[model samples]
Target: MFLAFFLIGLCIFYFYSIKKFVFFSQKSIKHDPPVPIFGNHVQVAFGRRTQTEVFNSLYKRYPSEKIVGYYKGTKPEFLVRDPEIIKHVLNTNFSEFCNRGVRRDPKVEPLMLNMFSEDGSVWKLLRHNLSPAFSGSKLKSMFPIIVSCTNKLVTVAKELALEGKEFDACILCARFTIDLVGASGFGIDMNTINNEQSLFLKLRELMFIKSNWQMFLYGIHDLFPESFIKKIHISRPQVRLIIKQILDSVRSQRTNDTNPRNDFINLLLELGKVGKISGESLETDANGKYKEMEMDFNDDHIIAQLFIFFMAGFETSSTTMSYAMHKLAFHPEIQQEVQREIDKSLAKHNNKLCYESVSEMVLLELIVKECLRLFPPAGYTSRISSNDCVLPDVNVEIKKGTKIIIPIQGIQLDPVYFENPEQFNPKRFLHETLQPRHKYAYIPFGEGPRKCIGARLGTLETMAGLAAVLNKFDIKTSPSSTRNIHPNRAAYLIQFIDGGLPLRLTLREKSSVISNGFP
Candidate 1:
């Protein structure tokens, strides 16, 4: 029968493939015991552990090895432990490891063509176009709007302080961030805190919908290429509607505006115009002189880039701010010290917090760094091989399709990298004693060319928001807080732990108005 022959052929192919890797292997590193098929992912199936925990365990098990090999379903995965090899993969021989390793065919999944999934030449070109948009000058231009959003957040916090005398700062912080993203990214004031049914909030809900079925489908898609094509799809109809609305508004506004607002949406509109009038690719001369390149910038490109920026700008920074508040609540002494610094800085000025004053807040910068170390926004990062390459010390070759992850959470918590890594010590960053830490050890925003494009803007927004909150009230941990934070495993990229960082906020005797010099 044809069915019998097909089954026999599949068995033969599977057996031969396994034998090619397991029996007649090119090279292999001894990894912690792996199960058949799922390998280390078996722990993930029962909810007994997370990918981060698995990676951390492997790191400890093979501390001496530069690269440890494991399998994510039959596919080989490299758990890169050595910083030297990590640097090579991320920087030195980057071409060989340029891809993010996610397989989402843009034709089949048109929405997946954003920065996170694109690879090689396509990634380079897209990254180049997007990078220039978020320069320091651009962020400075958007500072006032960010401050205004914070003002609204502080007002809400003040009301909550009066009502219950204590509240969850994380909730207020997240709400403020969501509002800021809507206003700054799309040039639309969402007022998410006041308007519960805002379109922006609805879009956010869709983004974080943690259904087990959705996770299972995505996991299957990640592990097995064949299943990815046939998996049940999850659609964000609300998000699509919001994007369509914004895009249409932006397009119309771009035509009418004599003087446009200095925000992301306006910049995108201008870029879209450039593509319309000119072309997509920049032209060059035979003599290497500047000439106009010609490729049309389509709606898809514009929408995709803007959507990515909105998602990145809001979520990552908000998560960082949340964790910082959580730690500050529990460690009141540190909170008091930070408040004193904010006070001293404000006292220098006529008592107004402005753009320039924020830059000069060195202590605030150190605190932010410490916060990033403890609760890195994007906990871990993975890269796929663009071509065959070998790690620095190891003879093992990483073939194309290999997934390499840098465990940011594990590295940040390693005592070897930080003294008492578990402790909430802001001073560890301030103090330059004991031992020198590795540069790549704390990659909160990642490193090299593919580093977070909006890192500066994200950090500035967070600092501005925190400064606004601290000026109005003193915060401490509520008794209902958790002792140790555990991530909601269902979500990706960010970790919002259980209990949601409840905190007690007492109104300050007087609100401090620090005049930051530069306008």
Candidate 2:
């Protein structure tokens, strides 16, 4: 009797699993065959293949279909290939697909409740309030802080040239960016550029270092439901404590201050004084006028925003500048052209690396844009449907809670839009050359209202760092440098080079180096 009951239970479980796995087939959507329990993301869940590789494979496999169905465990996801559909999801139909579907409890992990992780009304309010903090005037106010960091970077490069030591450009750029963020965002002197044992730098490395268990937890988080994942706390206790202590100290130091310093912390303090952050409502009234909505701005909110600012600002700019320098090392002619442009701009401004001077370097700007196109910091961006909606370009109905991935790397690398996509071509961004391509084809910073909030600040920081390095030294491929970079499979969100970016440096003539008061 016991054996018969066990057999009956097994049959029931198998049938239910089968029913869950056939969701795409029932909807008449084209999808890859899914295995039981693991679904189509077995390799990804196990860390055998990076998300980019999996998306790229699916993108190529279904050439004719605008949308391809796949499963992350039993949950169905849509991989969008068409540019028009991507634009619609990200822009025209944004109201129905605003959330990123990433969830974390604020009480468990206060650092995770930032603008990047939050969705719905909270995201809207925070975005509206923080948007003004990154304006042109505010960025200009912070230029001196960035220039100070770049000067230190140039000094380090000069020392490296004199020593004739080969170093990883990735690490070198990261140190410079960390110092910049410390000074400009938090009003602290990290001094990471000169000190190898900086506390903040060490903590940052520890925070991002992925272990086997952490990866497994991430897999479970992605495959299972949010409620199940919420029950298990994945964040490190020490890291959270350290961050909380630092924030508390900073807040205490500036408790009674009323003056504005134009830094990120100051802006947050001002917002807190207002008690709440307000924004235009996503839902419209009968007359088509949007209503206003607001949310609380407390200590937790402050810490969360500051955390994301530091993470996004430091990582994205450093990677971009490092990749640009690596590419310039291989292409001497292009490097020379960019240097000429930089020289002309500096000469016009009496050798000052100020905002106006860097802004005038058009050739350098094009090079940076091309570098971003080739290797975006965030390879892909995702959105989740809030309600059942039909894709504008393609007549396909997507159900609520369905995941949508916009493959930035695949789209930017497609030969249909870009000629010689494999080659490093800065000329493609010129007015005449760029006129013929689809507007939505290239999205390094993403699109629409949900685009990166710190785009201008990031561009300014990258260009400044690049100009500082190129003005003082000549970058060349070291013995350890590789022509092709392989993306690491371990890093799921941000794509990192498999091996570090190694390069050698040599000092330029004193006459060629701009040494008048600025980097």
Candidate 3:
């Protein structure tokens, strides 16, 4: 009786997993064969490949197909490779495809419910409340904090240059950005620059290295819907502990702060006092008019927002800065040309690294944009239909819960949109030299209303870091450094370098005061 029951269970398991994965074939879409439970993501789920690698492979595999179908376990997902189709998914009919495939419950996985991951009414309310914090005026107000943090970066880099030994550029930049985010976002002095063994730095590093359960959780995160996967926890215990501690520390410090600066912490404090996040809803009534919605803004919600802010800033900006530096180290002539631009801008602004001066660095802007094109931190963008709708360009019908992927890395690297896409050329972005392509083809910070909220601040931070380093130091390849960087296969979400970026730096004999700051 026992043997018979075991055999029956085995058959049922196989039947449920394999039989339900026929949506692609029934729709007559192109896709590779999937395994029983792992589906098409067996490699990523088991930690053998990076997500970007999988995206690029699938994208290049079917060049002719505008939309390709694949299975994430028993669930069917589509990869929209065509720019026209991508635009529809991202903007044209955004209301129908607004969820980023997230259905995690806030009570169970609260930290994951930030603006980046929340869906529908919750996302709408958070976006409304947080929009003002990233405004041009607010970023300008946060400029001094950013500048002070960059000075710490410069000082640390000066020490590393003087040491005359190769250093892990990834860790160095990560420290700088962490400090910047802490100061600018929360109005606190993180000062991780001086202490290499800081727990905050360690926590940041450990966050990306997924545990066994986390790997399984994220692997199937989009594969199954909320109905099947209820009460799932989002982060590791240590990650939660550290983030909570940071929040507690901030709250305690602010109690004594007579004058809280214009920052995220103050914004959060105000939200706490209000006791709710109310705004015009992203969802409209049948009449197409938006309704007002109020969100339950508890302490967990605040932590989730702050968690994403720190994680996003710490990983993305550092990767860009390190990659840009690595590229400059290889192409010194281009580095010199960019340095000239930085010098010119600083001189015009009376040798000060202010908002006005940073804006004037056009070449610097081009370089950062090109870097984003080549190495978008998000790798790929995915969304699920909020309701069934036919895509405008392709006219293909996707169901209410069907997933759509915009492979950002793959599209940016396509030779059709960019010439010699692998070759790093900043001039390709120059308006006079840029070839006309679909605007949706290059979305490093993504496009449309649901795009990256902190893109401007992140870009300015990247530009400032690169300018400061180049102004004061000469960098070159180190003996330990790899000529080309490969994304770490083990990374959870962010595209981390396979090995930390290592480079040798030397202080420039002729450096300007603006290398650190204007004063």
Candidate 4:
């Protein structure tokens, strides 16, 4: 009887697969052929090539397909390749596609309920309450923190020069960003730059490394939604302990009431107070707003927000800065032009760099934008239909459970939107004709209301570190580094493919000094 039932189930599944493919008209949308069960992601799902390389290869193969349907096991997903459709997914019909295909069941993984894991009303509340933290005024206030970190970075670079050895600026940058995030996000003075073996540095490695099976899990999670599989539990005893220590410090500082200042933690504390009162007195809105007026931040919410910010801020900015340096090493002309611009801007401020002065560096900003185009920190953004909805410029109907992928890597490197897409040309961004190419063509930080909340802080942190390095040293590709390095996809997040990239740096004694490494 069991054998008979198994065979019957197999027949049903095989027919269902055929019927589903026919009903969806999968071939009409996809230029590349989807495998019997694997779909277009055979290389990625099976771990043959890196994620970036796999997607890049597919993108090159079918450059003109506006949409492609592929399977993650038996689950069907669409990779939207058209610029206008991507724009709609990102902006116009955003409500229909607000939630990403990710879930961190708070009951199971308490930390998952944080900003990155949530959607709908929860996301709305977290995002709304936190938006002010990164406003122009807030970032302006936070500029001094960045400058402090950058000064440390410059000091480190100089010390390395004195040692007369290659400094892994990539690792150094990570340490600097970690310190900046620790100070601003959690109110911890984790001077990771000076003490390479600081608790913060170790925690960062523990939090972000890609081990054998651990590496495979990133792809598995992305390919197969967690609801369908058993949850992979990660125990960060050290991280949890560290956060408790940090919170204890915060609570102790609050008790003193002697040195209360404006920082992210303080802001969250104020919101928590407001949220608590609002939870009682005011009648709540449909979206969980209080109709009666009492406000206080949930204790967990504060921790979650801080957790996401620290994780997102430090690593994303560090990887991006490193990749930009890699791009510069290959394209020295662009690097020189940016260096000249940085010098010109600094000279205006008497060769002293400040937040306002950094803001005014147009070419510097363009270079950053161009680098982001090629090596987006978070390469792709995924969304699920919040509700069944039709999007503009497409005939295909999106159902409630259907998954949508915005191919950032594919679109950013597509020639149709960006002429000579592979070339690292900052001027492409400055050209007037290319100005209106596609709204979604350059969405490294993303677009519209749901864009990266930490964008301003990320940009400031990245610029500060890059400016500091440029001020003290000349950066070049190491002979050990790949000629044109590519990212490893299994270790997704912040665009790093390999364990890390290493650069060789030489001290800049005079403005016009040249070295063997210089192109």
Which 10 consecutive positions of candidate 3 have the poorest summed lDDT? Answer: 222-231
lDDT for model 2, on a 0 to 1 scale?
A: 0.83
lDDT of model 2 at residue 18? 68
lDDT of 4 by residue, 449-510 (tens): 67999887788778867866775577777766665666655453446646567667777665
Q: How accurate locally, in lDDT, is each candidate?
A: 0.71, 0.83, 0.83, 0.71
Q: Per-residue lDDT of 326-376 in model 2, one digit per residue for the tens?
A: 999999999988887887888888787889999998888888888888989
Model 3 steric clash pairs: 352-518
Sorted by TM-score, highest first, which candidate order results? Answer: 3, 2, 1, 4
Candidate 4 at residue 257, lDDT? 87
lDDT-wise, the better of 3 and 4 is: 3
Worst 10 residues of 2 by lDDT: 510-519
* Candidate that scores best on TM-score: 3
lDDT rank order:
3, 2, 4, 1
lDDT of 2 at 351: 82
How far is 442's C-alpha from truth in model 1 (Å)? 1.3
Backbone clash pairs for candidate 2 read: none
